[model samples]
Target: MTTPNNTEHANIAVITGASSGLGEQFYETIAHRYPDLDEIWLIARRKERLEALAERYPNIRARVRALAFDLSAASSYDELSSMLAEEQPVVRVLINNAGFEREGLLRDMAPKDILAMIELNVMGMTMVNRVFLPYMRAGSFEVITGSVSSFAPIPWQTVYSASKAYTRFLARALHEEERKRGVNVLLMSPGNMNTEMNVQGTSTGKLGHLPYLDLKRETARTLMMAERGHATYTPMLFYKLYRLFAKLMPSALAVKVTSIENGDTHGR
Candidate 1:
């Protein structure tokens, strides 16, 4: 009895880390897929970049909102919740993709960045779902961005791998928990996407280059898998093989192999 233009038909998609890389790709690519969407909420700390994303996709202007938000900052959640409550737009897609990582031994890493990795990757992701989970009804999709490092612990990037591992577990558990509610939760874990997070930075002794997937291609694959209700998606044959090897191989050996790739010979 519900018509296409009914008030209940309006829904929105929330994508974090929308400023650049895979997040930006999601902001662009996933909008058209949600035909029932009233708006797509772009959340990132950089307001300028979010605005730029809107400009790049001029056709979706009326359905796009740039919200300056820092996932690591716990206070942002209350404001987001208040706004969502006021707007009352049903969230059809929630992408908890805002995350950061510094590649190096834990001891040498900056304490602030380390804390932020946990805050955004683990705590922030959990809280984002908390605020929006109540609205995830029969058809809602929750996509959490994870990494190949999530399969197991890597020697150098200890904290980051651990955080993503936590995220992967959370996604898998939520997939089961929400199945009965008809809500779908999926974790999209990609390897070496050449993103700022993957490459870290030029200053660090990171690899000058590593085989990385195309951002747009991977993002499309992720969205496709999420639509299929896949609980955990590892795109790219290379990444899928890598994840398989990591899981089947011994933990210590996997860490050593990962350390070599990280350009960290002297594992801490």
Candidate 2:
């Protein structure tokens, strides 16, 4: 609740969606990997969850700041900007990981859900990057959590895929832009993982059968790739091959193939 002293030039890591899943994993990875960090900022909508996560690292060297902000709301960005101005901390790493997906046909999805996807996955992530990037000095790393769905137009997960495509392009472009400034921007396009966001259910259809990556290992690998100056990290050989296939195949055919592969035969 209390801000760190303004006079202290704390080296910090900022992680959005740090309440659970991959975001939580990123916190753990950063804690171990960057022991010199003076603070770790955990941003999410759930205050209690963020606090709980912070409590887990009580014995760690860095101070944990649990910032509960709903990134979908414009006010959250304003608040974060104010706090950053006050703290003026040196951002060692920034992870824009707050996003959600609602699986279904476009028409079947609620209007609010579609907008929410764009709000958080696209707008929220973009704003977080903008607000934090200035505080990140040379050698600081920024990671945008993309998805394998970004490779092509997926039928069932239409909005989620489209949003990730936005993230993919933005992150890659930023990588080039920031590289000149000696900052690294990494796009981590992970496939399905056993996280709360990817809970197994009947609606998952064929996606539930796909191989899931270990959250810890993949998170670690992503950080390693970023540290090595890689612009993007797509885990698992299967998804890697799929990315190639999506690139080589025609757009129309790829959409049709993905539709059928996911058991969506309504149009046919």
Clashes of each: 0, 0
lDDT of 2 by residue, 1-268 (tens): 2333436488999999898888999999998888899999999989999998998977789999999899999998788888888878988899989988876788878898899999999999888888888887778898899989899998877988899899999999999999997899999998777666565443245776777888899989999888878999999999999999999999899997776234321100
lDDT per residue, candidate 1, 1-268, as tens digits? 1112224544789899888888888877887666657788899999997887877766653378899988889899888887766656667888888888767778888898789888988999898888887766778888899888888787777888899899988989999998897889999987666655454434234343445678777778777888788898887887788898988999988877776334532110
Clashing pairs in 2: none
| Cα lDDT over the full model 1 | 0.78
lDDT of each: 0.78, 0.84
The prediction achieving the highest TM-score against the true structure is 2
TM-score for each predicted model, relative to the true structure: 0.88, 0.92
